[model samples]
Target: MKAVRIHQYGSIDNAALEEIPAPKLGLDEVLVQVEAASINPLDTKLISGDMKDYFPLTMPYTVGTDLSGTVVEAGLLAARWKQGDRVIARLEPGSSLNKHRGGAFAEFVVVPAQLLTTAPTKLDLATSAGLPTAAGTAWQALFETAHLKPGQTVLVHAGAGGVGSFAVQLAKYIGAHVISTASAANADLVHSLGADQVIDYRTEDFSVALRDVDVVLDTVGGETLSKSYQVLKPGGFLISIVMPPDQEQAEAHDITATFFGHRSHAARLDLISGLCDAGKLRVIVDRTFHLSDMQDGLAHSASRRARGKILLRPAV
Candidate 1:
């Protein structure tokens, strides 16, 4: 099988597409013939060794986590998923357990049966690959962690990006008044995705323009995150996916804040799939690359200019 692997953590240039032996199935695993996989910032971070402390990897690690494909084989105990079942899954990046193993950027991958979820029927398998990490993280931050409620105001930074795009749509679906920051070029795109207001980050300062937001979803850390605390009302919530929040700043602003790490949950993914099928959710694919052009894909993702998800198809 052809797979993209990094022999040692360094740069995207280190990633190579090469022929490797097919992964052997485990008692509780299912083998999936990869159709498409999505590239994320996490993939680049893992390859660059930026997350080595949280996600330690063995040399020659495969590169990817979110994938959508069809089942080709299943272990005896994993018979629940039969042949030809369309599935989507997010492989663990080894954050909690500190053991990274990624194989989504390949022709085939072995997935733990428990991690599998039925892909959305409304979207093609290639598009469904965008849902796992991006949508899952947005869902976790808004619903699971922050407990965002309807009729409240929330701010989402970089609302046109992968996780931000989903966050805007999901927050709007739940009846929140969504505000977002994006480049002026993406203003219309962000508004169409359900953002009630789109602040042009390049020309406008969000902190000075908005105030007393009920929640702030900080996808852009550093100065943006620092400024986010001031926009929230007292006792409001500030959730960041990029980095940890400053406890002192949170206390000063009388807001609750914390960093979020997305986890792979079959049930959550199933719910997302349902929303997709119902047309309440949309997958915005910025670009698609052939599996052989993984370096270009990785570089594109690292550029952080993608309007939505960047995907890789195994076949042409």
Candidate 2:
């Protein structure tokens, strides 16, 4: 099998595509013929050794986490899935418990059956590959953590990026008033994704233009995160995917704050799959790259300018 791997963590240039034996299946795992995979910012961080404290990589690590493909074989104990099943799977990052696994950016991969979910019937296998990480994160932030309600207002920072694009659509689906921040060039794209108002972050200060928001989903951390509290109403929620919120600031503002680390849940993926079939959600693909061109794709993701997910087709 052909796969992309990083022998040492330093740069995307360190990643290489090479021939390797197909992964051996375990008691509760399935062998998947990789059709499509997607890249996330976490992929870049893991490559650069920046996530060492959280997701320290095993040297000679394969480079992807999100995938959609067909099952070729299943383990004896994995009876829930069978040969030829079309599915989407996400390998949970920092899963200290599972040291032996295969990366999605390969001709084939071995995945724990429990992590697999039925792909959305409305989408092709390639596009569905973009859903697992980005959509799952947005779903967790808006519904699970913040509990955003109808008629309430929520601010989504970097609304044009991977997670933010999903956040805008999901918030609108929940009937909440959605406001999002993007550069002027992406304002129209964000609005089309269902944001009620799109603020040009480069030209306008969101803290000054908005007030009394019920929830703020902060994808951009640091100063943008610190200023987010000013827009929320007392007792509102501030959810950060980047880092933990400052406890003192939360206390002084009388609001709840939390840092969300997305966990791959089968149930959450099921709901997102349904939403896609119902047309209540959409998967935005910024670009697709062949496995041989993964370095360029990783560079694009690391650029922080993609409007949505970047995809890789191993079979391409």
TM-score of each: 0.98, 0.97
**Tens digit of lDDT per residue, candidate 2, span 77-100?**
988898989899888876743454
Instruction: Give the 10-residue window scoring lowest on summed lDDT in candidate 2.
Output: 93-102
Candidate 2 lDDT for residue 60: 87
Steric collisions counted per model: 0, 0
Q: Model 2, residue 73: what's the lDDT?
A: 93
Q: List the residue pairs that clash in candidate 1.
A: none
User: How high is the lDDT of residue 58 in model 1?
Assistant: 85
Q: Give candidate 1's error at residue 35 in angstroms.
A: 0.8
lDDT (CA) for every model shown? 0.93, 0.91
What would the per-residue lDDT of candidate 1 be over residues 187-292, giving only the tens digit for each residue? 9999999999999999889999999999999998999999999999999999999999999999999999999788889899999999999999999999999999
Candidate 2 residue-pair clash tally = 0
Measured with C-alpha atoms, the lDDT of residue 172 in candidate 1 is 100
lDDT of 2 at 190: 96
